[model samples]
Target: MTELGRFGVWVPHTEVTPAQAREIEELGYGALWLGASPGADLPGVAELLDATETLTVATSIVNVWATPAKQVAESFHRLESRYPGRFLLGIGAGHPEITSEYRKPYDVLVEYLDELDAAGVPRERRALAALGPRVLKLAAERTAGPLPYLVTPDHTREARPLIGPNALLAVEHKVVLDADPVRARQTARPRVEFYLDLTNYVTTLRRLGFADADLAKPGSDRLYDGLVAHGSAESVVKQLVRHIDAGADHVALQILDDDSLSTLRALAPLLREIP
Candidate 1:
């Protein structure tokens, strides 16, 4: 397995400039997870990797519906050959509502993994963006385990036993650096509301024990608290660490702020204390 350190930074591909990638590495984050389904060609990924000496750059996922498995495999091979143990491929079947071509997602994902396997993309070098029990099992069986997004620490605890002990359980967590609770939740709500519209996330949240009320748009306070780590840096770090304590090998922090670097910079020293 590639060294994902203990913590990673998760952001949209557009947010990570090459200079910022270097800074993230310097700040001691072990990996950089590109979210919002960076495509198979992985535009600008090379530059980010080039800028950072050691940071492991991974996709939160390359959408299976959008990119063919063969193309994704070829891109993975290209990066792996150049970077060796530095790149991790994360693949997912995007939502049905958003993708017209989305159908039989589980079967499609399995077939996609088959293609990658035939293309020689090592199982350990890739991960699945899984949420449901079935897909989680597939992730455990076929690849580097689940990189579930919009999840709580409780979900992490529940998922670990399902994925088993050896698989790399990397969970993506949203965070707000503000010390003020109201301000923090306000900052997190838009992003949280956005995911509320995604059925997969809402279903997972429901399974996690939230009712429809909690799943409602703008989200309940409980849902907001569960989904986003907020308040002081120390407080947020404590919340983020709960995912690790629950079973996550790595927690990808998606700082919900206009200036994400400020939050990353603040959290750097506190992160060193985490094992």
Candidate 2:
């Protein structure tokens, strides 16, 4: 299996053009994770793969509730045939608040995995957007591993044991490159606020030792700081390294701003220092 490199970047698919995709590859990012709930036909993924050589493209999540399992599997086969080892199929059972039919998510995910298995979407090339232990263990047993979002190093430390030693632990960390504490928090609070409405995220944050006060609307400074690394590129690298040290195989850095191409370009030299 081709390992996901130590560092990668996660950006919304709609925000990334083929030119920017190529720029990401040129900047030395090993993987480009598309943060889209792309149903069935993931043309954006194909577009990205076509734009760059040796750069892996993965769906941050293709929600199972919105897209049929067989359709997703078919899309995976189509991409894998053309892109070969460069496509990773990441599937998830999204939050209940947004999904009308979000009952028994664990069972639904397992059934979806079953469909993918039947359709010959290689297990090694698939990943799960998991946060809790049950789903994380399922990710280890059924697919490549869990691609946990909005997680801290402590979560990574705890998750490593449940997923065991072999499965890939790809964790997403948010970053803001600003030295001023007030400005950095200003950039981070809105991003954190977006996740607060979702029950899954709130539950996960609580599990990570955040109190009810911390998970409040606008969120506490402690909550925001824990979830996002804000400072110089070097400071962002330190937070990312914490996850790696906590047993994460891959850390997908998400820059909390509109202009990610410039952010990735600026952080490239500092990120390359990680082995």
TM-score of each: 0.98, 0.98
- Please give, for residues 60-104, the per-residue lDDT of candidate 2 as tens digits: 988999888888888888887898899888889989999886799
Cα RMSD for candidates in order: 0.8, 1.0
Positional deviation of 16 in candidate 2, in angstroms? Answer: 0.8
lDDT per residue (tens digit) for residues 81-200 in model 1: 788899999999989889987789999999999999999999999999999899999999999889999999999999999999999999999999888888889999878898888888
The lDDT per prediction is 0.92, 0.88
Looking at candidate 1, what is the lDDT of residue 105? Answer: 93
RMSD of 2: 1.0
Tell me the TM-score of model 1: 0.98
TM-score of 2: 0.98
